[model samples]
Target: MSPTKLLIGQIFIVFAIMVLGVWAATQWCAAMLGYQPQLGQAWLETWVFAIYRPWQIFAWWYHYDAYAPEVFDKAGTLAGASGFLGCAAAIAGSLWRARQASHVTTYGSARWAGLREIRKAGLLRPVGKFLGTYAGRYLRHDGPEHVMAFAPTRSGEGVGLVVPTLLSWTGSAVIHDVKGENWQLTAGGRARFSHALLFNPTDRRSAHCNPLLEVRRGADEVRDVQNIADVLVDPVPATDTSGYAGLSDSIDRHTWQLLKGVALSTLLGVGTEISFGDERSDLVRALRQSAQQNGARAGDQIVGRSLDIPPTLEVRPGWPLRVLVHRDVVLRPWRQGGA
Candidate 1:
């Protein structure tokens, strides 16, 4: 199957498992209280809240009359639940087919050239993939001046939203499957290598759910979150006042720092994996820069953590900071001490 379809499938499976699990649980609870479900906003709210917390059910029940509760029959929650389940199933089915085509790890073979070229262009196809490490020649970080412009979906029928980054490697490759997973790079740090990969999280549009790639050496880590820059460029088209104003200048110092992590990760892919530490940032300074770079319409006045900056700012610009990733898989396992 194609890599794109496979990616859609994995995303579908992930969402389906979450949504269905919640739907089933909600159904059971409603049955106890003599209710089913509905095809209303309440159903969505209910499903979201239920999976997040048990107290949410009570919260929904309180406001049911105004939203979903008005439509749900106390003894007929099953119908609503069934409708919700059906949608989840349908989305899963659609994505299942798409996902089947996206898991291609190898891309240099003669047959993969055209597809690999499209991916190399760094253009995203709307609702896309998770982390697909093709380890191919198509992966390279082009400066904003060279990166292509791809339109994100205004709405979606497939996998919500996604960004596909290609990982270009010159040395080794290390991947952070960060669903709370840790990665480690030990020794071999001197090997100069770089890698680029695409990132597409289903909830990419949300304030949360940032699935990006970070390559860190010590506390100094660089990251690439494609959306951050695009959103900044959204307000108006490029004006001629400044060279950087154009889409051509979309990549900035922040972006350069972000890619450091990408280079470190792929460098360690073939060697060993070991722990390094995470970077700490000055929220005040980072907020100022992030907001400024993002066209002054960024996060709340309340400053927050961002992976785009380096850990410590006291050091000179050339130094690196490293962190520990607990789940580093160095040496790829030994087989009976054989060579």
Candidate 2:
């Protein structure tokens, strides 16, 4: 039954018991006193006395005179005791019933979702993100729902969960395989389905992708260069560090400035000509001489076009510096000059 109905029923039963106990006690009092009072009069008096003169019921027991044979209201005392016992039992029963009902409600609502529910929700699928095994069947969530896993170290997060999903998943996935174990295990199988590439910074044989190459010449060129510079000069390391922690603030600022200048020049096709001599005229003279040499090389022949040169160029670390000239440019002089 509902809690409200159960509580109402308990209250009615308790009131009835209290009334019956008071009536029985009044009847016993009348018979002992040998007086027949009006109907309901004795009951009313007994209830009033029970409330106001409760001490009178047990007074005779505590202050009993052995020499006197005066009668006491023993029945009233028994009735009061029974009434208290009945109320206590009712309260205990109410608590027990409520506890039992709560347990039933909780157990009904907290059960795991069944196979039918899973299927209805579209979580049981063939090609999708893996959830777990249930009822000897593999469960997958094909819907666009976010999944997260939290597990301690040495647990089979990769082998048990990740590898299984990677092997089954046909869609594109970009995984950060720190130990390279995931690539080693699943690369062969996945290669058959899709083109897989591994990019490791420490590995020399890994694919090379220059971020600077992506910088284009446009209105947003400065913003793109700034973003790349921020990433390069960011002091926060992605993982733990061992030796040579980082550069100081001043040095980092200087490096950022240098990178920004070089990147802007390269992407914008503007070069800062550095002259070896101290005078500004020396730099102008060098440019004039270079132009005269280029004109002489053309030898009155109309040069239809000149190749565009990147204003700035980067030589990656651990590599020998070499000049990169356009194929259309004459290289006979440089070859003979041992340049």
Candidate 3:
């Protein structure tokens, strides 16, 4: 199947499993309660009524006369105030937990934490994998080198969102099968590579899912600089100031995912994945300038052929960034026993 369709299928499967499990549990609980006299209804009430009762009450609140309080008594007033405080506390507690959950791992062990911890605490596992797998053409992160780096772009343009991806050589060219199992090619040797499936907040209008590719050195770690300015640029419409306002939902719904461990968008608002280094702001400016230089039309993609600035402009020699801008550029799938 095509990559896009396969992505949609995986998403459907995840939700289907979750929903079916919830329904089955509900049925089993109801059946047990109907039969056994010893098992009190308190357990079922806690699970069912405590969870769904709020919504049920809200739905019927206006339809019932019980909400019309004819009493201005001190007791009634105190009860109402307490209820409001309870609701407020619930909301505040939820927001606090969400902030804590989305906390990015900056230093130490969490940076290299295993998949189990990552899938649970990272909170970006589901959609990140969906988008990465699709954009990377079924490749997966081979190791535990996932990094939640802050993108250098402007806030609404795609920065401020904790972008997570495998960014090291040990985290290079990992491939996966149709069942989403990780596997490396038996023949090829390992290479120093970086891969990130980034979504732009500005390009929310366009459907281009940007996949950034940076190639610095091979497995041998030899660095031969190419004509390409170590940066790849795909241009947007020169006139459009809001160059790809990426999926607004992705940013807005991120906090919720932190709390619930669920991803919102699996298909919508995917933008072009351009490969660049830590010099993202500079690279974006250069790509725009290149677009202007090429006389690119509204929908044209202006690809960078060489460095947009001087060689000495911004040099990070030890960790040089490489980029492949074209749609067809494909690197070898990371293999086993190659370094």
The models' CA-based lDDT, in order, is: 0.40, 0.62, 0.34
lDDT of 1 by residue, 17-113 (tens): 5555555545444444444344222333453242223223444455564555543344235434645665676677666665644544476435543
lDDT of 2 by residue, 150-246 (tens): 8898788777678998898999999988999999999889999997788998988577887777776577776777788777874332121354432
Ranking by TM-score: 2, 1, 3
Look at candidate 3 and tell me the lDDT of residue 111: 45
Model 2, residue 102: C-alpha shift (Å): 8.8
Candidate 1 Cα deviation (angstroms), residue 68: 14
lDDT of 1 at 11: 65
Using TM-score as the yardstick, the better of models 2 and 3 is: 2
The most accurate candidate by TM-score is: 2
Error of 2 at 85 (Å): 25
lDDT of 3 by residue, 6-66 (tens): 4455455545544444444333333433423332233334443422211222222234325
Ranking by lDDT: 2, 1, 3
RMSD of each: 34.9, 19.1, 32.2
Candidate 1: stretches off by over 4 Å: 1-112, 115-339
TM-scores for all candidates? 0.17, 0.41, 0.13
